[model samples]
Target: MPLRLPPLPALRFFEAAGRHQSFKLAAAELNVTPSAISHGIVGLEQALGVELFVREPRGISLTASGADYLSYVSEAFSLIAIGTQRLPNHRADRPIALSCAPTFASRWLLPRLAGFRARWPNVNVSVDTSHRQVGFPVDGFDFAIRLSRAPVAGTAWTRLFGERFVPVCSPAYLETLRDGHGNADLRRATLIHVNAASEDWQAWLDATGIEGFDTTGGLRVDTIQLAFEAAGMGLGVALGRRPLVDPDLDRGALVEADPATIASTTAYWLVSAENGDRRPELADFKRWLVSEAEHLETHADASGQTVRAAVS
Candidate 1:
């Protein structure tokens, strides 16, 4: 008898949902809705004639069957990625194509790219920025930097840095709020928001639990780099993550608006294809990248003594 198989699309959804342990997160990875993931998984369960998840009131958990099946599916995907990466065209001299989040590409990596180029003059690299997670090996990108509190989809998930948030603005902008303490006069100032990310003024505000100011009243930009740029130009106060703002702080172009910092559980992960370890340039890149992140201050509060200012 011929072997039975679930629909390929359903299998893919099941794998993603199982790996993340959340339909919502799985939907994010697959760029679909949670309902779609649920439907797909339901379809798969019907096809397999088994319960794959133990659905609870709050969230879903994988059944023993689902966990066992996921291990196999994940391994198969890894094997495919490894095989593709080992092809003849993936030569040592081929320029390492790195994909990254747009903000990270502009603010973090590109600024430090000169160091990498100088260290490996003979090697070449091309950087592509995307908000979506691309398929490893199939996307033709050798590596990618993912910003998340959890592991990103792919094989090698080496952590590069943990994230922390602080509000930053030009020195001139800070002067405007000199008499203002806390959210008092600061509420009237323009706010800069990175629309693509969740690390917004609202998130920072939530973490700090400082009330009264409107978190939504700000200039919204598509990327975090633009947020910093606007803040540096005194356009508004931007919630700056440590990984991207440390350079600005060091140069005196920007300063902390508040001394309090919101430490992010998510960090940057260096994700790559399954065969990334076997690649020639990966070792060099990882070593240099790790060293740079190690030097970034995760706990330093640069903004002067934090104080409560009245919402004047």
Candidate 2:
């Protein structure tokens, strides 16, 4: 049997009114007047031969038929939206959607992405930098790299690498410390704080079991990357992530404060929807990611030796 579909504009009007229970609000969203919205709904109800909504004194309510149809309408709209979003990717030569933390994207992922692109020249990568947790199926992301101690529930997760924390400062700042007689003299130096995670400084202090130094005295920034930059500019000493700061350390832009360090409770992870098992793109991206991660681990191990030697 052929499906008899209502006019799309009328269906859209009906759906919006049903959702908000207000013709005026629906009109605002649809960029039409309230009368236009109401007229459209009435026309739709007439076509369907059913009263879809009850006109209440204060507002409006859905009729039984309206409630039943509303469910189908909402689902239809959702599917339409999803389809619309996927259209561009479908036509593109290489389509991959990746989401990750902003700082991690800037510091770690961006540097290594060129390699991925070189290996898979046909793959088009779209990167989204957001702190919000992205859910699969609903979020429409193909894959994500996340920093956390535990995998997000209900997702396929792979540990990319562990992270460690170290105190870092610019060469100029280190010179100041050396001139002032060393890190133990940092009591008089400026400290940079990352406001997002208050425990970072405390964790380093606890790991080193260092006492008598005030960890809280300094300029506070929202992101680790910003703090790292501030430290590079000799603004203050920043608590740094080992992997993210490796380049700076190698360039002699920053120096480690101590040989002792603590493993971050949070580690970098590669994640995809459990249902993404069947997606060829997701599979290829995952395999590529694992290999890249292994390569990074090897590089970091070698870099750590140089950092230790330079500091010693």
Candidate 3:
């Protein structure tokens, strides 16, 4: 059966009014007068045989039916926008869409992006750094770096690198403690914690069997990057991942407190649609990602050995 569709102008008018609950605001957005917006919305309501909005003297409010319909309409428009933007001819000069966790993108990928750009100067790369999982077919992302223990189902997955977790502090913070390389040493310093992973500090304590430590002291942050920053400012000792803190460790902004690091159950996974085999750009990206992961793995192994040696 053919789908009956409302006029684009009417739908646009209704969507704008539903969003802002003000015809004046809708008119401003549409670059028309309030009466024009009202006319369009009224026409839309008549065509649908329902009162979409209740007009109050001060403003407007959605009826129950209008609220429900507005949700679907808003979603439909969002999907339409995504579809139009992702269309081959409609897209900007950049052709690749890469989704990543914000922390990973900021701490690791951003630093190394110049290398990828140097190699693929013509291929445009678009990065999405939302924490939400990207739905391959629905979200239309070509590739993603997901921080997870397992690969996403229904997609081709490549393991990136296992993350190592350890206690880290700024040089000045550590100098104050003076003691090095034990669970006991950490107890004397202020401890920074990431609130998102509530169990991380407990897990570290359980693994190391450290005593007399107050896990709840100092600053509590919502993100690993923020925790690291706080620790770097001599706020406290932060439990950090090697990938996110490696550059800091190299630059002397932070130093690992213990050689005994915990291997995170979760690791970064490189994911793409199984059907991504058809696109040349997708294929190139997957190959590049695997090579990059291999490089990271090698460096991680060497770093682990160095830490072990230093601790011994």
Candidate 4:
């Protein structure tokens, strides 16, 4: 007896189209044109005697059947990837590729990666700083660290830690905020704003119930790192997210302008495919990352300080 199956290429097209819900995107991922993807999917539908996608005026969507098929197809691909990595000839020292936002990569992960390297001398880690949504295996990344209010769908994820934002500035700038009566006055202080996090300053003000300060005037920078740098140079007060601002606070480069802190809805998440941990090196990396996050949380709990938010 022989197994009945559609052509492998057709299956690939169908899976990609269904996953992205866009023939254009599927074509891009497969390095083919939209017409080619459409033809391949039509061919697949004819072979299976069933339609996988529901064509719409604006775009395409997976039929209920298509969604069900995608689950199986995706799982099959994940298993193949795991099995291939487990083969005897597979390189055990293959580098672990990760995707994350630039601010996180620079302010937090990069500073701490040396510790991971010291622990696992054999495993090399590659980091790609991207704010775009990335797919696993398709993007050729072993894992991704995403900041989101909720877990990303269609992937396995672990919440690393939540974030809290506080206003930070140089010691001199902090002193400048004080009046002759030694009372804190923010009306005269410059507000340094990160363009990406434009609402942070206002959010902090609202959360702290601090009135009469105009958040409209500020020096706007594109990234949190740049904002922190500007604040360090005495440009203005930047709303600094904890863990990201821990190093600056520790080194005396930045200080909390106010003790009030506002919690962020978003948290850092470690994301990967279902079988991402099957590889020995990847499994070790996951364990180490989780352990590091736990250690940081534990240390923060015991410190009783708002500025020193995490592990030293």
List TM-scores for all candidates, in order: 0.66, 0.68, 0.68, 0.74
List model 4 lDDT by residue over 1-312, tens digit each. 898877989888887888788999888877999999999999999988888899989999998888999988877766666677668958767799999889889888888889989988988999988555566665568899987778867799998987778889999988989989997677788998887773477777766677898877879889888988999999989988888999999999999888877677677899998777777878888998888888877886686755322221
User: What is candidate 3's local distance difference test score?
Assistant: 0.77
lDDT per residue (tens digit) for residues 1-312 in model 1:
997767988988988888778899889877899999999999989988999999999999999988999888877776776786678765668788888887777778888889999999887888887555566654467788887777755477878876678789999898887663534256667988877785567667776777888765679888788888999999989887876788899999999887777677567988886557576687787778777776653344344434332111
Lowest summed lDDT window (length 10), candidate 2: 303-312
Model 4 pairs whose backbones collide: none
Worst 10 residues of 3 by lDDT: 303-312
In the range 227-269, model 2's lDDT, one tens digit per residue, is 8899999997888787888888888888886556666667789
- How many pairs of residues collide in each model? 5, 0, 0, 0
TM-score of 3: 0.68
Query: Candidate 3: where is the Cα deviation over 4 Å?
Result: 1-93, 179-184, 304-312
TM-score of 4: 0.74
lDDT against true structure, model 2: 0.77
Residue 224 lDDT (model 1)? 80
- Model 1 TM-score (2 dp): 0.66
Pairs of colliding residues, candidate 3: none
Task: Score residue 167 of candidate 1 by CA lDDT.
Answer: 82
